[model samples]
Target: MSGFVAGGPPPSGQTSPDGHINTSPFWPSIDLDALRGTLRLDNSISPPRLETAVIAAAISVNRELAAWRIEQQAAGYSKLEEVPGETVKGVPEQVHLYRRAIEAATGAEVCERYRSYDTTNSGGKKADDIAPNIDDYRRDLRWAIRDFLGTTRTTVELI
Candidate 1:
């Protein structure tokens, strides 16, 4: 048989930049392909509405991921602690990392909401004025989510 197929190159013709095979026997499907069609609608409505919905969805997913991570960590710690006399100090570090990751992912959402509220009520407000409250809220939310995820350890460091 020839090296090349009738329609195209062989299954292993070439590798992609990521070092994976370029060809797939089966076609891949995307769940959000419908959203692409929404973009082709007439301009009767503003585009910012769609942008806002996408952002909201992203924020929700971020929160959910953080909650899930906390739950996973808590389960791990519980299993570790169940061993008689075993100590799990790394749980604190893991919790800290989880909080940091959550903040890093959602900081923009918190800042944007603060800025929007401040701009609507007050004439002008710098990010510094609202940062303390934002940090406090983030800490509180992290603790709440962690606790909800089965973490009995209440002491949390907000740094």
Candidate 2:
């Protein structure tokens, strides 16, 4: 037999490029392959785990936007896409920002969970190095959600 495998679907643990992750009825479904490619996630993450992370991210994003969503619905915009936004490339800016929020939240969740995958001394150091990145991911998430909600990122606190 040749080294090349016969044509077929991806292995059990791998994700199909055409797969989509459905979100709440008001939100758009996310493209699984697009997220994996954009995040540079590889097959090391099984499809189930990837799906779990994506779902968690979606839930978090939806919760954060819950009030805004209700307001939009009251205004007669039945879906997220129906809410007006500037077009970026061929997509609406709100959709892009919403996707970005999900991706950032997923990145943070994955990195935090995988930090313990390796327990060697070097792995400990690696985990330390990733700490700042996790914070950055969180920051990105906040910015995306705020942008989607049409709010400023700054926080005012009396000190």
Candidate 3:
């Protein structure tokens, strides 16, 4: 895939191809296929373990994206400034797409877990929330994998 192209006129000191104003800087190329392949592998292995892995992976990727966006905003990118009465940044759209796919893939199991935890916590009781506990989430994820694969394996080493 192509690298990120910063939208707008080029930097002040740069010259354009026509020896006029620089149009824009060509950003480094991003290998979207590689990224998708990595993420897809995180999804495809051990169908039973899919829910936990997918959710955890989604959260991890989302956090990284958010941090990157923050860095870009700090660097005076179009993250804050409006362009023609409209927002210029596209991070939110990307995040929404990721979130929707993840939810669609694991919605049933996650919803059940969510309701269980939610109801338990509603009685003025302190129950551990499943969504925020990565270790427990991973353990449960492993269990799901084991169940789906029909094995009592405890460790899955992905190389």
Candidate 4:
């Protein structure tokens, strides 16, 4: 108990005993299998190369989703699920979404829908001047996170 830190994320690959932060990455995780099913690699690229990319992508996505899981935990929704394993079970629903996100990432880097900050161009158009077209996978994740937060975003007008 002395090593435990309160009000923060759980340790990697395991959840808190009280189910506080169950957002840790799955233990004994092998993203390669999932990646194999999702992707069709050419003979040119070796298995290890593909495996490394998938693992890295999964880890990245997992870390990012942890914040959302933590947020849900804070809001009293303790069921922010993840893939199940021996002696472990979490949000099964979210697993596919996360996997697809990883697959999409590995296939081709998802670019920002809109450009970053930039000045006006000679033709009067500018980068990031318009709305972005987020991919379905990303949009779904965003929606899920927003839903897990258990509140709809509302705008307020001040007069």
TM-score of each: 0.28, 0.86, 0.21, 0.41
lDDT of 3 by residue, 87-147 (tens): 2264333333333333333433432333343354352232233333434434544454344
Candidate 2 per-residue C-alpha lDDT over 1-159 given as tens digits, one digit per residue, 9 for 90 to 100 = 111122343366476455888877889998877777677765656667778889999999999999998998999998888888789897889999999999999888877876877899988987787788788889999999988888899989999
If candidate 4 were superposed on the true structure by all CA atoms, what would the RMSD be?
Answer: 15.2
Which one wins on TM-score?
A: 2
Candidate 2's displacement at residue 25, Å, is 1.8
| Model 1 TM-score, 2 decimals | 0.28
Model 4 lDDT per residue over 1-159, tens place: 011112333234332223211224342244443444444433323344555455555666667667776665677665534323222154354554555556555443222311332344722342222223234444544554444344463548899
Q: How far off is residue 129 in model 4, in Å?
A: 28
Best by lDDT, which number? 2
lDDT measured at residue 82 in model 1 versus the true structure, 0 to 100: 28
- Runs in model 3 with CA error above 4 Å? 1-62, 78-109, 112-159
Q: Output the lDDT of residue 132, model 2.
A: 81
Native-referenced Cα lDDT, model 2: 0.80
Candidate 4 residue 126 C-alpha distance from true site, Å: 31
Candidate 4 weakest lDDT stretch, 10 residues: 1-10
Model 3 / residue 112 / CA error / Å: 4.3
**lDDT assessment of candidate 4:** 0.43
**Model 4 misplaced stretches (Cα beyond 4 Å):** 1-28, 72-91, 109-159
